[model samples]
Target: MDKNIVFLLNFKINKASSSRKRGSRLIQNLDSRLRGNDKRVKVKKRKKFVLLSLVFNYILFVIYRLSYAAKYLIN
Candidate 1:
């Protein structure tokens, strides 16, 4: 009877350890996915910032040209 009890305890310990390993794997997968998503979002935001700066520079160029033309006409 004592041997049977020992065997049962060992089996339970093995099962519990396996389940813990599976849980750890699941958490790692979730963490990796979140990191990937964060990188994508950062890339998109940088692209948007670059596009906005380009547009602003174009507008400034146009304004400069218009002022220069007006000065020439006045002279």
Candidate 2:
């Protein structure tokens, strides 16, 4: 009877350990996926900022060219 009890206890311990390992692996996978998504969001924001800056610069250049043209015409 004592031997049977020991075997059952050992089996329970192994089962618990295996479950813990699986849970940790699941957490690690979720963390990596979240990090990947965050990086993509950051990249998208950076691209949007660059595009807006280019548009603003182009508008400023056009305005400067228009002012120069008006000045030449007045002369």
What tens digits encode model 1's per-residue C-alpha lDDT throughout 1-75? 368755755565565566887656555554555456655677899999999999999999999999999999999
Off by over 4 Å in 1: 1-29, 32-37
RMSD of 1: 13.6
lDDT tens digits, residue span 1-75, model 2:
368755755565565566887656555554555456655677899999999999999999999999999999999
Poorest stretch of ten by lDDT in candidate 2: 26-35
Go through the candidates in order and give the clash count of each.
Answer: 0, 0
Supply the global lDDT for candidate 2: 0.73
TM agreement with the true structure for every prediction: 0.54, 0.54
